[model samples]
Target: MRTIVITGGTDGMGAALARHYLGAGDRVVVVGRSRAKFDALLTSATAARAEFIAADLSSVADGRRVVEHLRAGHERIDALVLAASFVRQRRHVTAEGHEASWVLFFVSKFVFVTGLAAQFGAAERPVVVNTAVPGARADAIDFDDLEMSEKFTFARSNAQQRRANELLGILAAEANPDLAYVTWGPARIVRSSFAGDVGTAMKVGAAVLGKLLGQRPDAAVRPVIGIIDAPSPGRAAFRGAKRRPLTIGAHDDKDAARLAAAVEDGR
Candidate 1:
């Protein structure tokens, strides 16, 4: 049986994915911040194939804790799914001293994937799937203000973090030629606990739009399953079920390297 590691698997699309894999007889270890939510996800029927590790991924230390736990237990990882992401209406910094959204969406993901690279290399068919918005291109990373302390806005932070995730996929593919790195975008906003933390107007709008246009969490997770089950060459980015061409930023290499350095520094 293939072993899969999933972040943010307590709720939303991540939870749906955990159930899907458990149904297919794969071992799923879900890492999340909430023990209550994790308990809710575990049922008598699926408990045998599932495990949970509690972690608040908004900090680098917590990210490393997860990596260490996995490395100690599993020698090989068939798939690593980076599905934990959220957008906060106002900017908040974590204890690790980085923008909360950026940490959750990009920084922590880089730490987990890179920290677990050796396990990935040991696998027969290794795959890393990042469920972040695709092609949200950014010109470069602002070295002086990586956290956007100067003028932090939700839109700017979201765009920058999404771009960072895409660049991460490229860099990861370059570093680990044996692994398949895929970045996926669900395209439409769906009903999620994340919406509760946003502004009231945005929350209402998303809820309405979700009902009208958003794909259900189960439906949204299908493409991710496809990416995991069907191995592909190199790196690819997808929106929904279709492959879309990505626009790489001019300073992507420099930005990616800088980000990698920051992750290594554990900031």
Candidate 2:
């Protein structure tokens, strides 16, 4: 059986994907921040095929620890699913001294995938799937203020992080042609705690929109599975379950190189 690693697998789409992979008879390793939640998730029969690791990915150290643990335990990883993410109402800095949202959504993911590059290379068919919205294609990466110290807004930060995911995927694909990197955007909002920290108005509005347009958990996860199982490499964002071209803002090769350098330096 193939081995699949999923971060933030205790709840939401991550949990759903974990269950789906378990049902398909794959060995699944779920990484999350809560031991209680992991225990609760393991109560099912399919839990036999699953393992859990707890880490607060908002810290780069914790992210590296997870990658180290995986490297020590597994010979190869068939799929690495970077699905850990959350939206906060305001900016919060973690003990690692970086903005919490950026750490979890972008920094930690970059570290994990790059750290485990060797294992991925050893696999028969390795794939990395990042679950992030492909926000405005014109969104540019702020090199001087990646942590959003200058000005922070939930919308701007989220969009920037999403854009970073797409650009990172492109760069990663170029660096490791043997590995398939796929960035996926949700087709519609699903009922989850993702927006629990937002203001009341946004919560209400999200609820209404979800009720009107949200796809069921199973339906939403199908495209993710398709991306993982795709025959060819996926180097762009997938929206509405189809591949779409990415638009990197004014940043060119120099910008991408700078971003890569930053990620390496941060690690």
Candidate 3:
């Protein structure tokens, strides 16, 4: 059986993915901040194979903790699914001293993937899956003021974090030629528990948007699962269950190189 590691598996789309993979007979290890929730998943997941690691991805130390925890038990992971992300009400700093959202979405993911490259290197068909937010293209990343405390807009913050995820995925593909990297965008999925963590303004905006255009979380996972199961060569992005040849994200070789370099510099 192939071994898989998933972050943010406590709830939402991540939890959905955990169930999906485990149901498929894969040995699944879920990483999250909630011990109670993780334990509950373990109890209910007897039909499928599953394990849990309580980890807070918002901190650099926790990244190390997660890696060590996994290494102690799992010798290798066939795939790494990075579904751990959070929305902050305010511009908060993580224990790692970086913006909480940025750290979870971009920095920690980069560190985690890079640190565990050796594990995937040994696998025959290792793949990395990153979820992208489609609306993120509207906002540009502000390297100068990452915290966004100056002018925090929920949409803008979400967009920035999404863009970071896409960039990181591309960079990951460039860094590891043997591994396939895939990014996916689930449009207007509302069945997920994302509403609980967003800002008040965001919650209101989402309520309005939901009335206009929102989809069930299961609708989003179809495409996400496709990317995880069948990653494309070069850089590929998926929407729904089908793989799209083209996406709005920057996926050129130069952009991917730059992303890799930036991630290395951050280390």
Off by over 4 Å in 2: 43-45, 248-251
TM-score for each of the candidates: 0.93, 0.92, 0.81
Name the runs in model 1 displaced over 4 angstroms: none
lDDT of each: 0.82, 0.80, 0.70
Global fold similarity of model 2 (TM-score): 0.92
Residue 174 error, candidate 1, Å: 3.0
lDDT by residue for model 2 (43-141), tens: 477778888999888888899899999999898898999988766878998777788888899988888877888888788888998887765556456
Ordering by TM-score: 1, 2, 3
Give lDDT tens digits, candidate 3, residues 1-267: 888888988787777777778777788888888877766665454535777777778787788788877777777778887888776766786555666777777777877777787787777777887776433552366655655767877667777776666666655665677787776666554555563365577777877776567776555577666665765545566666656553354444555455556556653
Model 1 Cα lDDT, one tens digit per residue, 1-267: 899999989889998888889888899999987778877877787788788998878777788888999999999899999987666889897766777877888888988878888898888889998887777756635566778898888777778777788888767777679889888888666566663368889877877887887777888888899999997857788988899887676777887888888767755
RMSD of each: 1.7, 2.0, 3.5
Q: After superposition, how far is residue 98 of candidate 3 from its true place, in Å?
A: 1.8
Collision count for each candidate, in order:
0, 0, 1
